[model samples]
Target: MPSQEALSAQVGAVYTTSTGAPVAEPYAAQRVGLTGPLLLQDFHHIDLLAHFDRERIPERVVHAKGSGAHGVIKVTHDITDLTVASLFSKVGNEAPLTIRFSTVGGESGSADTARDPRGFAIKIKTDEGNLDWVFNNTPVFFIRDPAKFPHFIHTQKRDPQTHLKDADMFWDYLSQNPESIHQVMILFSDRGTPDGYYMHGYSGHTFKFVNKDGKFHYVQIHLRREGGAKSLDNDTAQRLAGENPDYATEQLFTEIEAGKFPTWNVFVQTMTAEQAESFRYNILDLTKVWPHKEFPLRPVGQIILNKNVQNYFAEIEQAAFSPSHLVPGIEPSADPVLQSRLFSYPDTHRHRLGVNYGQLPVNAPLAPVSNFQRDGAMAFNNQGFRPNYQSSLAPLQYKRKAYEDVKHEIWLGDANVDLSYVTELDFEQPRALYEKVFSDTDREHLIYNLSVHLGNVKSPIVKARQLSVFAAVSKDLGDRLAKAINHPSVEPLAVKPATEAIRYKLKAA
Candidate 1:
C-alpha cells in the first residue's frame, strides 16, 4: 500500500497560493501592525479567506448523501451478439471503474441507514469512452411520467413553510400516484435500507443494446452482490441510523482500505422489440419490471471494488455519472424518465460542476475527445490550437457506424400528455411481489415497516387513501397494514388500468 502522503511531491512543503505563489505565513493575517485593520494588499490572506468562504459546491438535489470507491469490471461473458459495446468485446477483458452509492432524497449529512432507495451509479472508463450506468437498488420506481418527477421529489423533501419532513407530503404523493405503490412496497421492504453498498442494483427503465447487425434488444441491467443482496431489518436499520448515521458509507471505505474488497456481478435481461410489444406491461414504464421467468438474467461481467478513494471531495464529491454517458452500441429507451434524465443530469452537472465538468479528472473520458466545444469555466483543455468549427485545412475525423439500416424508433403521439393511469395490471406485479417474491417473514416485516411510517402520518384522509392503494394491491396486505396501524380502509379512486394503453392502441387499430 502507498503511504498517506504519496501524492505530495515534497515531504515538507512551503504554503502556496491557489496559483502556487509561495506563502510565508497563513495563520496570521497581514494587519496594520497586528492591532489595526487587515491589509487588503495581502493576496494570500485574501485568497485564503475568499476560497474558504466558497469552498463547497451546491449539494445534489437528490441522491445527496453518497459514498464512492474505485474498482475494476471484468467481462465474464461474450455479449457481442447483443451489443457492440467494447467493454463486452471479449470474455476476461477488464475495464477500470468507479462507483458511487447514494441515498435518494436526503441531504449530504443524512443518515446512511435512512429508508430510501439507494443510487447504484458506476462509471466505466473503457477504450471507447466512459459508459455510466446510473441505476438504482430497486427494479422499479415510483412514478413513470417525467414531468411529475419534480413534483414527486418535492413531496419527498421537507415542507416549504414548516421546514420539516412532512409525512402528509410523502404519503399523499404515493397515495395519489399509486403507480408508485410497487416501488413503495420495495422501499418499505427490507431492501430499502441495504446492509451496505455491495447489495443488488437495477436499471428500472428499459434501455437498448444495438448490435453490429443492426439488431437491437430492449435491456434491463442488474447487479447482484457477490454473495447476494444483504439487507438490514427495519428495527436494526433505524437503530443504526441513530447510533451510527454514516454506518454504510464508513464501512464501505474501511472495508476497501483494509483490502476486504466487495464485489458484484453484472447481468442483463434482454427482450426483442417484438417480445417487448407483446409483453404484459409497457416496456418503457419505469414503475414495472420484466418478469425474470420470461427474460432471464444473463451474466455479463463482474464488478470488484478493490480500492478506496484518497480524496472524498476531489474524486467522489466532484464525480458525476449519467445514464446518457453511453460509449457506443447503447442507447436510452423511450422511457420518459430516462429520456428526461438524458437532459436533466448533464444540466445539473453544469450547474453543480460547471460547464467543463467533463474535464474534471473524475469525470473525464479516457478515450481521446475531439469536439468543437471549447472555452468554459474550469476549461482544463480547450482543444488547443484546433479550429472550433469545421475547416477543410484540419477536417475533424469521424467514426463509421458499426451497424447500418437499423430500425430507428420513432415516437409519435398527441402533444398532450396524461399520467399512465393505474389499472388492475398495475397492481398485479406488486401483488405477486408481496405474495410470491417475499418470504412470510419479509411480508410481515414490510407490513410492520409501512405501518410504523404510515401511522406517523397525522391526516386520516391520507392514511385512508394509502390503505385503499394497498387494498388494490391485495386485501390481505391492506388488511394487515390497517390492522397494524389500527385504521379503517377507504376505497381508492379508480383510474384507467394498464390494459387501457393496449385498449387505446387496439381501438386505433
Candidate 2:
C-alpha cells in the first residue's frame, strides 16, 4: 500500500483552485482591516466556498442509497453461439466491471435493512462498448404496465401532506393493482430484507440476445452468489434498521478491503421466438418469471468483486448503469416497463449528471468515441478541431453490420394502445410460491410480517381489498393473515379474465 503522502503527491501535495492555480494563503481572505468584513475579490476564499456549496450533484430518484465495488467479469464458458458480445467471445476472457448494490425506493439516508427490492446493477467494460445489466434481487416485479411505475414509486415515498411513510398509501396501490400481489407476497416474506449486498440477482425484464446470424432469443439473466441467498427475519431486520442502518454497505466495503472477495456465477435462460409464442406466460411481462424447470440456466461467466473503490463519491456515486447500454449483439425485448426504462434511465442520468455524463471518467466507455454531439454543460473533451457535421475533408470510418437486422416476425400483431389488466394468470406464480416453495417456517414469518404491516393500515376497505387479493392467491395465507391481524375473513374476489385487455380496448373505442 502507498503512503498517504505518496498518494497526495500523485495528484498534488498543495491545495489549489478547481483550475489548479497555486494559492499563497488559502487560510486568509482579503479584507479591509484585521477584523473587517471579507472582500468579494478574494477569489481563493470565495471559490472554495462556491465549490463547496455545489459539491453534490442530484442523487438518484430511485436506488439513491447504494454501495459499489470494482471487479472483473471473467467468461467461464463459451457462449459465442448465443450472441456476438465480445465479453463472452471465449472462455477465460476477462473485462473490468463495477457492481452497485442498492435499495429501491429509498432516500440516501434510508436503512439498508428496510423491506424493499434491492437493485443489483453491473457495468461490464467490454471491447465493443459498456454493457450494463440493471437487475433486481427478485426474479419478478410488481407491475408490468409502464405507466404504473411512477405511481408505484410515489406510493413507496413519503406522503406529501403528512410527510411520513403512509401504510394506507402503500396498501392502497397494492390492493388496487392486484397484479402486484406476486411481488407483494415476496416483499412480505423473509426475502424482502436480505442479509446484505451478498444476494442473488436477476434480470426481471426479459432481454434479447442476437446471434451472429441475426437470429435472436429472449434471455433472462441470473447471478447466483457462490453461497446461496441469505435473509433476515422481520424482527432481526427491523432491529438492524434501527441499530445499524448502513449494515449492508459497510459489510460490502469491509469484506472487500479485507481481501474476502464475493463471487457470483452468471447464467442466462434463453427462449427462441417460437418457444416464446407457446410459453405459459407472456415473455415480455415483468411480473412473471420463466420457470427453471422449462428453461434452465446456462453458465456464461463469473463476476468477482475483488477491489474496493478508492473514493466512493468519485468512483461509485457517479457511476451509472442502464439496461439500454448494450453492445451490438445484445438487444432489449419489447417489455413495456423495460421500453420505458430505455428512455428513463439515460434521461435521469442527463438530469443528475449533465448531458455530458458519459464524459465522466467513471461512466466513460473504453472504446474511442467519435460523434457529432458536442458542447453541453461540463463538456471537457469536445472533440476539438473536428467538424460537427460530416465533411469530405475529414471523413470518419464506419463499421459494417456484424449481421443482418433480424425482425421479430412472431411479434407481428394488431398495433394498438394496450393495457394489461389483472387476471388469474397474474396470480399463478405467487400461488405456486406460497403453496409449493415456502416451508412452514417461511409461511409463518411471511404471515407475521404482512400482519404487522397491514395491521397498521387504518382503512378497513384497504385491508378488506388486500385480504381478498391474498385469498385469491391462497386461502391458507388469507386466513392466516386475517387471524394474525384479528380481522374477519372475507370471500375471495373473482380474478379478471384474460380478455380484460380486449374489454379495455372496447371501452376506449
Candidate 3:
C-alpha cells in the first residue's frame, strides 16, 4: 500500500459520482451507434436523466416566479413597549432574514416585467422563533373574501378552453365584481410594471403586532425601498418581455453580487381595537386601506440584503412561510383572507414538501421542537428510539405558557356564519383613488392602459359592461375610457337586465 500522503494525492486527482464510481467522460452518453438511441446500461446517463426528470417540484399557485436574498433586519428604533418580539426588542439588534419578491400571477418562465402586483414576502429568524410577514407590493388586494380568491386568480390565468390569456375573461370577472376596482386602477397605472425588485412597497394585509406586558395592537407592516418605487412604461415593459423575459431577476442578482446591496425601511401602522371598530371601511376587508391621515406609519427597523442563495431550489423553493407561524409577540387578526391563509399556507407546504416538511434545513426553526407528532414520510430526523408520545414514566414534562403572556386581543363575535358580502363602501377607495390620488398624467396613463387591454375584447357586451363599472366609479372616467375605445356615448348598464318597456321608455323621443 502507498503511504498516507501519496494515497490522498492520488484520490484527489479522480472525480466520482455519489456512489464513488469514477466518471470516465461526463460530456457524452453511451450509445449503440453514431445516431442510435442512448444505452440504458450507462448508469451515469440514467442517474442524470432520473434526477433531471424530478428536478422541478410543484410550482407555487401564485407568486410562482420570484427572486430571494438573505439579509439582516436591524431594529433602528425601540418599540419594546409595543411588542416583545425579540427582533424588535431593542435598537441595534439584528436578525437573519430572507425576502422574496415576485410577480403575483406569472409563471416561472413568464416575463419579469409584466404589469402585476409584486409579492414582497419576508422571513425573519429571531431567537424566539421564525416570523413571516408575507406581504404584497400593493397595500390592498383585488378581493376581500377568500372564497373569491380562486376565481379572481383564474381570470388572471390563461383561459381553460383556449389555453391563452383572454381579455374577455379578465374584464368580465372585474365587471361582475366591482370590489376589484381599486386594484384594477392601480394595475392599469404606471406603477404596475415596476422597474425591478428593488422598487416597490410591501404591506401586511392583516394587523399583527404585540408588545411587552401582553398589550397588542392591529398593525400593518410596510417596507419602503430605500431607492423609492420606479417603473418602466408599457412600451418598454412590452419590448423587454419579448427581448429579455428575466430582466428583473438578472438585475437583482447582479446588483447584489457586485456588492450593491438593496435595503428597505420597515414601518408599521398601528390601530387600537376601538379605532378598528370606528373605522369608515371594514378594517378586515383586504380590498381597502386605512388612510394614512388617521393611522400614520411609525418607523421601526431596516432590512438589507447582503447574501444570495448558492442554490435556488434548496434555499428559495423549499423555504416555507405561513401567517400562523407567529412568535410570542405577534398574532393574527380577524382579516378573512389572512385567517384562510393561516390554514392554506402550511397545507400547501405539506403538499409540496413531504409530511414532515418543517424538518427540512431551510424550513426548520432554530428553537428546539418537542411534540407528540411522529412518523411520516421523509422523516429524516426521527428521534431515535425515543417515545414519540406524552408519557409519565419517560419523565417528559410540558410547560404551559399563559395566554395573556402573548399579545392578542379576544374578540366576541358569532362564529356560525360565513360572512361574505360586497358593500357600497367597496367602491369608495377605488373612486377616491381615481379622482383624488392619481394626478392628471396618471389618470391619462390609466385611460391609455385600460383602453389598450379593453380594446382587445371581442365581445361588445363585455366591453360595455366593464365600461359601465368605470362609469360608476366616475362619469369622466367612463367617458374617457369609452372615447378611447371609440364608443363616445357609452351608458352605465343596470345591475339586472332591463325590460323591453324600460328600454323603450328610456329611448323614447
Candidate 4:
C-alpha cells in the first residue's frame, strides 16, 4: 500500500493562482479597503470558484450507489480447450481484478438494502485484454426483449408527476407483461434482499466462452460465494435501511481491511450450437436458464477480493465495464439484450465520463493499446508520434488466425429484422420454475411477499391483470393470491372488464 505522503505526491494539491504562483493566504479575499468591494483581478479567488463549480462529473443513470474492491482472479482449472481466453488458458494464472456491487435502480445516496437486484461486475486485467463480466446477482431477468428494458426500469423508478415510487405503475407493467412472473417470483422470495455483499451469487446473462482455436460455445458464468447465500427478512431489512443505509458497503470494506477476504468459485455451463438448436427453451432468452441436469457446471476459476480501494472517487467511480471489451477466444451470443448492451454500456460511459475514459488507470487494459484512433478528451497516454492512420508507408502487418475450428450451425428461421415475439414456449420454463423448482416453504414466502407489495398497488385493474399472469403460471398460485388479497377468482373479474377478459382467459386456461 502506498503511504499518504507518496499518494499526495502522486496527486499534487496546493492553493495557487492559474499562473502557478502560490497564494499567501487562501481564506481571505482581496479587497480595495476594509469591508469594500473585492478586486476583480484576484485570480486566486476566480480560479477557486471556477474549479469548484465543475468539480463533479455526471452521476450514473443507474447503479449509482455502489461499493468496489481490488482483488485477484486465480485460475484453478484449465479449460484451454473451451476458451482461448488467456485468463483461463493456464492453471494458477492470476490477473488483477476490480469488482463493483450496486443496487440496480437506486440513486447515489439511496439505501443499499433496498429490495432490488445487485450488480456484480468484475473487470479482469488479462494479458490479452480487460475482460469484464457485467452480471447481476440473479441468474434470470424479468424480460428478454431489449425494447421492454426501458419500460421495466421506469416502473422501478420515480413516477413522472409525483416524483416518487408508485406501486400502481410497477404492478401495471408486470401484469401486462406476463413474462415477468418468473423473475417476480424470485424477487419476492428471501433471496431478494441479500444479507451483505459477500452472501450472494453472480451470473452472466448471455453465454460467451470460446476455445484456444477460436471455437466458441454458448456459456453462462456463475460465481457462488464460499460462505453461501444469506438474506435478511423484510422486517430486518427495513429496520436496517432506516438505521444504517450504508451497511452493505461498510461491511464489505471493513472485512477486507481486517484480512477476512471473501472468495467465490467460478463455474460455466456450455452448450454447443447443435445442442442450442434443439433445446426445449430458447437458449438465448434472458428470462430462462438451461437445465443444469443437461449441461453440468464445469469448474473454471476462483476470485478472492482482498484489497479495498483507497480512494473511492478515483478507483470506483471512474471504473467502467462493457460487453464489447471481449478478447480473441471469447465472443458474444446472439441474444438481443446482450447485443443492445454491447452499444449501451460504453455509450453511457462516454456520457458520464468522457470519450477517452478507457485511458484511466482503473479502466486501462494491461496489454499495450495500439490503434488508429487517437486524440479525445483527457488524452493522457497518447502514443507519441505513432501513425494515427494505417497507410502504405507505415507497412501495417496483420496476423490472421484460422477460423476452421470455429463451430458452425444452420439457422432455419428468418436471419434478420427484429426477432422479438411471444410464444407458448416462453411460458414453459417459467411454469416449471414456479411449480417444480420452488419448495412449499418457498411458495408460501413468494405469496406473502407478492401480497405485501401488490397489496399496496391502488389500481384494482392492475392487480387483477397481475393475478391473471400468476394464474397462468399456476392455477393454484393465482387462486391463492386472489384469496389473500380478498378478490374473487379470475372468472368473476373477467366479466367486468371484457377487453382484459380475453387476455386473462387465455392465461387462465
Candidates in descending TM-score order: 1, 2, 4, 3
For residue 149, what is the lDDT in candidate 4?
86
Best-matching candidate per lDDT:
2
Model 4: lowest-lDDT 10 consecutive positions:
492-501
Q: For candidate 4, write residues 1-509 as lDDT tens digits.
A: 54456688878577667788987798888898999998999878888898999989888888889999999999999888777777787899999999999988888998888888888988999998899888888888887778888888999999999999989999998877766766787788877888878554545465557664566787888888987888877768778899999989989988887899989899888888878766655566677777889989888888999988878988999999887888777777767778898999999999999999999999999898888779888999898787888867775577454334443422411221233344455466667867898788777877877788888988888988888877766788888888888887763112133223222333356
lDDT of 1: 0.86
Highest TM-score: give the candidate number.
1
- Alpha carbon lDDT of each predicted model: 0.86, 0.87, 0.78, 0.79
Worst-scoring 10-residue span by lDDT in model 1: 408-417
Residue 71 miss distance in model 1 (angstroms): 0.9
Once fitted onto the true fold, the runs of candidate 3 whose alpha carbons sit more than 4 angstroms away are 1-14, 27-42, 393-420, 491-509
Descending-lDDT candidate ranking = 2, 1, 4, 3
Off by over 4 Å in 2: 1-12, 24-26, 409-418, 497-509
172-274, model 3: which lDDT tens digit per residue? 8888887777888889998898888756565647565666555678788888899788878888989999999999888888888778999999888888777
Number of clashes recorded per candidate: 1, 0, 3, 6
TM-score of 4: 0.89
Error of 3 at 140 (Å): 0.3
